[model samples]
Target: MQRDFCDPLGYMGTRGGDVTATMAIVPRIQQVRDCAAAAGLTIIHTREGHRPDLSDLPENKRLKTARAGAEIGSRGPLGRLLLEPRPGEIVIDKPGTGAFYGTDLHHVLATSGIQNLVLVGVTTGVCVTSTAREASDRGLNVLVISDCCAEPDPLEHEMAIRLLQIEGGYIATIASTVDFVASVNTLAQS
Candidate 1:
């Protein structure tokens, strides 16, 4: 999770939104990450950010974030708001809400022969959902772990999962962190 979204005095906090729910999902996400790593599954991280000159930011999105106190390119306690590629992790920087748009994510997936996608991130209704939808559209089987994602508003977080399921369950399969971890562990043992 980016500091801008998770850190108090950062984006969400500056706009008076409680950061409790967002922070609460961190452990579950880490649990998922560990299981996926042990299973030898690829873990790709997606980050939303604009260029230094804000050239890639759309007018509406810029206005929205500015009003909410997350000025593009602004640094938080965790340093820059975007992302840095960690060793052995693929980091995709996205200009828009979804990761695939204007990014090589699709190409990377195809080249790497990845078919199923598991998503875990902050703001379930936004970047995470957007990425799930995009991946589904591209024929990737998507699974979003319920407890591993959070929104500032819990209702939206819950609703986003339902919305994805309403499309005949083609959008994404929603799971809990416990179930996902068990499945991954079983696969690892096999």
Candidate 2:
């Protein structure tokens, strides 16, 4: 999780947004990421950011960020508006909420033969759910780790996950960090 979204001294927290629940999922996300890496699964990270000049940011989003006192592309505690990915990590910088919206995500997935996607990110009702829906619409099997995602409002997060579970699993398949890791281990051994 980026400092802007989860850090108490960062954007969301400084603006009176509660980030306690979001910060709590970091460890769970790490566990899931490690399990996937050990299993040799493709790991792609997405970060919300705009160009340094803010040319690519939409007007509505730009206004919102300005209101929050964390305008996109401006410097933050994480070096930039978004946290930089480590070397060798496949990170996709997204201008919008959905990762595949304006990025080469589909090409990357197609080239890598990635028919399934494991998603873990913040703001369950927003970014996380957007990516999940995008993946589902693109014919990718989506699994959202319940314990590995967070939103400022606990009730909204719960409702978002519940909505995805409706229609007999139409959108995404939900799992816990423990269950996801176990499944990865089982697949690795098979």
Off by over 4 Å in 1: 75-85
The residue pairs found clashing in candidate 1 are: none
lDDT per model, in order? 0.83, 0.85
Q: Write the per-residue lDDT of candidate 1 for residues 106-162, one digit (tens) a residue.
A: 999999999999998888898889999999999999999988888888999889888
> Which candidate comes out best when scored by lDDT?
2
Native-referenced Cα lDDT, model 1: 0.83
Q: What is the lDDT of residue 30 in candidate 2?
A: 80
Which number leads on TM-score? 2
Quality of model 2 by C-alpha lDDT: 0.85
